[model samples]
Target: MQYRRFGKTNLNFSVFSLGTMRCLSSPKNVRQTLIQAVELGINHIETASSYGKSEEYLGEIINSELPVSRSQIHITTKIPPTADADKMRWWIDESLKRLKLDYIDCLGIHGLNTWEHFDFIKQKNGCMQAVEEAMADGRVKHIGFSSHGSLEVIIATINTGLFEFVNLHYYYFFQRNYPAIKLASLKGMGIFIISPADKGGRLYTPPPALKSLCQPFSPLELNYRFLLSDPRISTLSVGPAIPKELEEPLNFADRTEKLTIEEITIFNSLENHRDSVLGTEKCSQCYDCLPCPENINIPEVLRLRNLAIAYDMAEYGKYRYRMFENAGHWFPGMKANRCTECGDCLPRCPEKLDIPKLLEDSHNRLKGKEGRRLWG
Candidate 1:
C-alpha cells in the first residue's frame, strides 16, 4: 500500500485507511476483515464512539487476531462535540476503554458539521480544552475534526488553526469541498477523505451510465484514481462492509502513486460527458442564488437534478435530496418543493437559468420519503 506523511501529525498513513463503521456486522467477519486490511499494509484503523461496537470489535481483534504489535498500528477514534469539558473528557475515556488502548494516535471532534458544533468546540473550557488536557497527559497524540458542513463553515473551522488534521467529504462526484481541502492543505493539516466510495455518489454500485463512463476502470477505481491524483489528500477511508470489499482497493493501492495517461483521458471524458449531458442546465455553484426565502440550497438542488438527469444518477440523487429535513445540520437544506417560485433568486443567477421552474421540476423528479444519514 502507498503511504503518505499525514500533514502536521507526521504519521505515515496508508493511502487507503480502514474505516471501521460497518465492521461490526459479525465478530468473525469483522475480525477477518480487520486482519486482512492490516495484512495488506493498512496501518490506520479509524473508528468512532458512535459507530456501535466498532471500538469494541477493534479492541477484541487488535493485538490478538491481527499480526501486528500495538505500536505498529495507528488507531483513530472520534468523539462528538460537547460544551461541557467534563463530558468531553468522559467520552474520550470511554473511547479508550472500548479500544483497550492507553493512547489514541488521533482523536477527532466528530461531526463538526455546523456553526453550532464549532461554537460548542471553541467555547471556553469546552471540548477543545478537554482534548488539550488529554494531549498534555499523553492520552491523545494529535487533534483533528471531521465535518460535513458547508464550504464556508469548513474554511472557518480550518482557519482556527487548532486542528492538526481534518476529515471531510471530497470525491470525484462531489467537488464542492475542494476549496476547504485546499485551505486545510495550506494550513499543513492532514487531509483524510472520508467515504470516497459510499458517500461519493454510491460508486460501489454505480449507475449504468456512470459505470459505462468509467470504462476500463471500475467506478471505485476511477474515483480512487481521481482522488489520489491530488497530492493534498493524505488518506482515503475505506469502510468495507465485508472482507471481499477490501480486495479491490488493496489492488488499486499498487498504482495509487500516479495515474496513467489512459486514466487521465478517462477522467477528462467523464467530465466532458457530464457537461455535455448537463448542457445549459448545469448549476455552476456560484452561490449567487443564495438566501432563498425557503432556505433551499438552490445550487445543490440543481446539481443533484443535473446528476439525476445527465448521468442516470436518480437513485443517488433521491438518496441525498430526500435527506433535506432529516439529516439536520449534517446536510442542512430544504427540499426544492419549497421554492415557491419567488423572483428573488432570479436576478442573482448569472447563468440566466429558470430558477423556479427548474427547482419545481427537480422536486417532482427527486422527491421521495426522507432518508436518514449514514451517521451523524
Candidate 2:
C-alpha cells in the first residue's frame, strides 16, 4: 500500500484508513478486519464516540491483541460538540479507559455543521477548554474538526490556527470540499476523507446518470482513483462492512497503475452532466452551503429531490423528508415554502446556485403546495 505524508506531521499514513462505523456488530469480525488491514500495511484506524459501541469494540480488540506502542500505529477519535466541557472531558477519559490506550494520536471536534456551532466551540470555553486540556495533559496529541459545511467555515476554522487536522467529505461524486482541502494542505493540516464511496449508498450501483459519466471505468474504481489522484488527500476512511471490503481497497492500493488520460476526461465530463441534471438554480446536493438562516438542510432536501427525479424514487424522497421533518432538524420557518426570495444564499454558494428560486420550486414539489410562502 502507498503511504503519504500526513500534512506537516512526520508520520506517513496509508492512503486508505479503516473506519469503524460498521464494525460494531461483531467484535471478532472487527478484530480480524483490523488485523488483516494492519497486516496489509494499513496502520491508521479511525473511530468516533457517536458511532454507538464502536469505541468499546475497538478498545477490546486493541487491549486483547494489538500492540500498545504509539509508534506502531496512529489512532484518531472524535468528541461530539453536544457534550459540555466537563462531560467532554469525562468522555475523553472514558474513551481512553475503553480504548485501553495511553493517548489518542489525533482527536477532532465532531460534526461541526454551521458557523454558530464553530463559534460555540471557540467562544463558550467548554469544548475548546476541554480540547486544550486534553492536549496539555498528553491525552490527545493533535486537535482537529470534522465539518459538514462550506469552504467559508473551513477557512474560518483554519484562520483560528487551532487545529492540526480536519476530516471532511471529498469524493469523485462530490468535490465540494476540494478548495478547503487544498487550503488545509497549504496551512499544514492533515486531511482525512470520510466515506467517499458510500455517500449516496453502495458502489455496486450508482445513479444511471452518474454511471454514464464514469464511462471508461467501473464506478467503484473510478471513485477511488478520483480521490487517489489528489496528492493533498492523506487518507480515506472507508467503513468496511466485512473483511473483503477491507481487502478490496488494499488490492486497489497495491496496484501501481495510475488513472489514464481517458479516465480523467470521463471524470471531468461529470461537471457538465451534474450541472445539467441538477440545474443552475438548485442545490447540487453537496451540503456545502448549510446552516441556513432558518435551519433548513438545503443539501439534504435537494438530495431527496434528486433521488426522486433521477431515480424515480419519489416515495423514498417523501419518506426521508418526513423523517427530517419529524426529527425537527428542519425548521418549519425555513421550509422551502418560507423562502422570501431575499437572495441571501446565492453569493455564498461556490456553485453559484440560484437558492431562492430552487427553494421555491422544492417547496412546491415536496409539500405539494401551490405558491410561495414568505419567511416572517
Candidate 3:
C-alpha cells in the first residue's frame, strides 16, 4: 500500500486505512483480514469505543504479535463527545485496557456532529478537558475528531486549531465537505475519509446508471480512485468484512498516480448524463439559496431528490428521505413539503428551480402510500 504525509503530524499514513467497524461479527475472519492488511502495508487502523467487540479483537491480535510488529502500525480509537469530563476520562482508561496497549497513536472525539455536540466539547470540564488529560498522561500522541455533521459545523471544529487530524465523509456523490477539506488541508491536519464504499452512495450495491458511469472498473474502485485523486485527503477508511473485501486495497496498491485523463472525461460524461436525466428544472446545489427560515437543509433535500429522479432508485431514495424524518439537528427538517413557499429562496436560486413545484413533485413521488417499499 502507498502512503501519504499526514499533515503536521509527520506520520506516513497508508492510503488505505483499516476501519474495524464491521469486525464486530466474525472475529477470526476479520482478524485474519486485518493481519493481511498489515502484510500488505496498511499501517493505520481506526476503531471506536462504541463499535462492539472491535477493541477486544485488536487487543487479542496485538498482544500475540511481536513488539516490532505492533510498533510498525498506528492505532486510533474514539469516544463520543459528552459534557461529563469524568466519564470521558474513564472512557480513555477503559479503552487502553481493552486494547492492552500502553499508548495509542491517535485518539479522536467521535461524532462531534452538531452544534450541540460541539457545545458539549467546549463546556466547562467537558470532552476536550478529558482528552487533554489523556494526552498529558502520555497515552495519546495526537488529537483528532470524526464527524457526521453539517459542513459549517465540521469547519467550525477544524478552525478551533485543536485537532491534529479529522475523519469525515467525502466522495464523488457527496462533495458537501469540499470546503471543509480545503480548510483542513490548509491547517495541515490529517484528513481521513470515512466509509467511502458503504455510505458513499451505497456503491457496494451500485445503481446501473452509476455503474455505467464508472465503466470498466467497479463503482467501488472508481470511487476509491476518485477520493485518492485529491491531495487534501490523507487516507480512506476501508472496512473489510470478509477476506476478499481486503483485496481491493491491495489491487490499488499503486495509489501514487493522479486521476487519469480518461477518468476525468468519464466523470464529465456522468455529470452531463445526470443533468440531462434530472431535467433543466432542478436544484444546482450552489448553496446560494440557503439559510432557510424554517431551518431546512435545502441542498441535502434537493440532492436526494436528484438521485431519486436521475437514478430511478425509488426505494433507496425514499429510505434515505425517511432518515430525515425525526433526525433532529443531524438531518434537520422534513421533506420539501415544508417549503411553505414563502418566496424567500425564489430569487436566490440560480437555476430558477421553481423550488416550490420541485419540492411538491419530490414529496409526491417519495412519500408514503404509493412509494416503493425498501428492498428485502
Candidate 4:
C-alpha cells in the first residue's frame, strides 16, 4: 500500500482507507473484512456514531479478534453536530467507550452539510469548544469535518481554520467541489474523498456506455486514478460490504503515478461525449439560474438530466433525485417537480435551456421511490 502525508495532522494515511459503514452486514462478515483489510495493510479505519453499532462492533473486533496492536492502526470516528457543548462532550465520551479506546486518532464533526450545522459548531461555547476540550485532554489527537454541502458552505467551514482535515465528495463524475478542495489544500488540511465508487455515479455497476468509455480500465479503477492523480487528495474511502470486495482496490491503490497521456485522453473523451449528447443544453453549473421561487436546485437537476441521458445512469440519477425532499439540509433543494414555471431562471441560463421543460424532463426520467441515505 502507498501512503500520503495527511496535511497538518502529519499522519501518513494509506491511499485507500477502510470505511466501516457497509461492512456491518453480519458479525462474521465484519470480522473477516476487518481482518482482511489489516492483512492487506490498510491502517486507517473510519466509522461514525450513526453507522448502526459500527463503533461497538469495531471495539469488539479490534480488542480481541484483530491481531494488530492499538498503536499500529489509526482509528477515525465521528459525532453528529450539536450546539450544546455538554452534548458534544457526551457524544465524544460515548464514542471512546464504544470503540474501547482511551483516545481517538481523529474525531470528525460529522455531516457538516448546511449553514445551520456550521453555525451550531462555530457558535460561542458550542461544539468547537467541546472538541477543543477533547483535544486538550488528550482524548482526540486531531480534529476534522465531513461535508456533503454546497461549495460556499464547505469553503466557509475551511476558512475558519478550526479543522486539521476534511472529508468531502469529489470524484471524476462530480468535479463541482474542486474549488473547495483547492482551498482546503491551501489551508494545509487533510483531504479525504468520500464514497468514490458509490456516490461517484455508481460506477461499481457501470453502464455499457461508461464501460466502453473507460476501455482497458474498469470505471472504478479509472475514477480512483483520476482522484489520486492530484497530489492534494490525501485518501479515498473504500467501503466494502465483504472481504472479497476489498481485494480489487489493493491492486489499484499502488498505481497512483501520474496518468499517462492515453489515460488523460480517456478522461477528456468522457467530457466530450457528455457535452456532445447535451449539445447546447448542458448545465455549466454556473449557478446563474438560481434564486428560484420554489428553491429548486436547477443546475443539479439539469446535471442529473445530463447524466441520465448521456451515460445511461438512470438508476444512479433516480437514487439521488429522490433524496431532495427527504435528506433535509444535506440535500437542500426542492425537486424539479416543484417548478412553477415562473420564468425566473429562464432568462438567466446562458445555454438558453428551456429551464422548465428540461426540469420536467429530468423529473420524468429520474423520479422514483423515495431514496434513503446510507447514513444520517
Would you list the C-alpha lDDT of every candidate in the order shown?
A: 0.88, 0.72, 0.81, 0.90
Q: Estimate each model's TM-score.
A: 0.96, 0.79, 0.89, 0.97
Candidate 3 runs further than 4 Å off: 65-68, 293-295, 312-316, 326-330, 336-344, 364-376
Residue-level lDDT for 153 in candidate 1: 80
The ten-residue window of minimal lDDT in model 4 covers 367-376
Which regions in candidate 4 have their CA more than 4 angstroms from the true location?
371-376
2 against 3, candidate with superior lDDT: 3
* Native-referenced Cα lDDT, model 3: 0.81
Q: CA lDDT of 242 in candidate 2?
A: 78
Better TM-score candidate (1, 2): 1
lDDT of 2 by residue, 112-193 (tens): 7667767767876567888889889998888888876556777788778888788887776456577888889989988998
> Residue 84 deviation, candidate 1, in Å?
1.1
Cα RMSD to the true fold for all candidates = 1.7, 5.6, 3.4, 1.5
The candidate maximizing lDDT is 4
Tens-place lDDT per residue, model 3, 1-376, is: 6799888788898998999987567768767878787877889999999888888788888757523377788899998899999999899999999999998889999888889898987787888898898899899888999998888899999998989999998988788899999999999999999988777777777778667767877777778889888888899898988767887656875765798898888778878877998888656779887888766677877887887777655655666677655555545666678889898988999888887787778777766544332222
Query: Which scores greater on lDDT, model 1 or model 3?
Result: 1
Q: Sorted by TM-score, highest first, which candidate order results?
A: 4, 1, 3, 2
Top-scoring candidate (TM-score): 4
Ranking by lDDT: 4, 1, 3, 2
